[model samples]
Target: MERTEKETTYQETRRVQKGDFAAAGQISASYKNMLKRLGVDSKVVRRLAIASYEAEINLAIHTLGGSMTIIVYPDHIFLVVEDTGPGIADIALAMQEGYSTAPEEVRMLGFGAGMGLPNMKRCSDTFEITSELGSGTTIRMGFNLLN
Candidate 1:
């Protein structure tokens, strides 16, 4: 059977800079505001907010820099976070709760508890991640509006 594909009706991309602690949550905040203005479901907004914030914090703390893209369709909200940095060597291990490789400084800031990826997955309707040891990592999360 052939499947039909839906076209994206809206999209936005935000750039994240390395170690930009001062601006860590800006992208997620902006998207949250936009979602609110667009009348997205509060539950969906809350899930996206949590996931987006986690992804943004990861980029700031782990990667050199990256961009996050938000795509909205009739059925779903999609988020793509890609970063240029040392990628995870063991995705399985990284996904475990309370297992973190964050440096001491980041831990001191109360940011790295090894829950980012797991939380994002938990909040998303769909989640996928790919990484290359010395290259980078990309994470994709989707929130279904129909849920």
Candidate 2:
């Protein structure tokens, strides 16, 4: 394959602090901006924004703290969210709608009524989640840019 246009790609990592209202939507916004800057198709950008925000909110609200990294590539974007908080015991159950482990306070704030993982899956072309009882969790999502 001969060279064509100059490839534009980058990686960004940010720490998400639990219970930080000000920082809640920052990661998602950043991800969206990056995609927009890359001139990604509108459909891909929309889906990516939704998936990225859902994962980012899950990390900020459910975990004590965590990190999110976005890897931009030529044909796709990858997102990894890793947390050291209490791990989800049942991945299957967690994937179900309305099966939330969020506390009452979180609910009152209209944050976690489940739906995070499910939404992530719905938005991404590929999604995977892994967690251990006491070992925390990691959610990986990939959005394909080429249609």
Candidate 3:
């Protein structure tokens, strides 16, 4: 579901620049810290941390630019990640575990083992993704608080 900050009682958004390796994990780590401080369940925080880090890494390594947003609802936690351009050509294929389009150098860097989307989906209570070949990708994930 498409949502804005107004829909939530609490929200945090961070812009991710393309190829910003130096600042790669900082954004998601901040999200984890905020979630913990807000008294979110430890398990939920761990799942979001994993999913957010994956989304953050994908945006930093793949797209032109994007944002990572966290929205807190009464019974759920939501994440929205949106990117600029060069979106996935095949979302079905991309969702497959161990399937990656990463370059040789990126793989050599010990990242992009094709687990990002799969991990995000596995960790979230609900997940949706949209992508256009030349446009961009957006991923929405929800985690249930009662879980």
In terms of lDDT, the best-performing candidate is 1
Ranking of predictions according to lDDT: 1, 3, 2
Candidate 1 local lDDT, 37-142, one digit each (tens):
8899999999999999999999999899998999988788899999987888999999999988888998888899999999999999999999998899999998
lDDT of 3 by residue, 70-98 (tens): 88976788899999879999899999999
Candidate 2 local Cα displacement, residue 20, angstroms = 1.9
Q: Give one digit per residue, the lDDT tens place, for model 2 in 26-140.
A: 7888778877888989888888888888777787778878899887779878888999877898999999989998888877877788888898999989899999877789988
Q: Which stretches of candidate 1 lie over 4 Å from their true place?
A: 1-6
> If both were scored by lDDT, which would come out higher, candidate 2 or candidate 3?
3
TM-score of every candidate: 0.93, 0.90, 0.92
Q: What is the C-alpha lDDT of each candidate?
A: 0.90, 0.83, 0.89
- lDDT pick, better of 1 and 2: 1
For candidate 1, list the clashing residue pairs, or say none: none
Give me candidate 3's TM-score against the actual structure: 0.92
TM-score of predicted model 1? Answer: 0.93
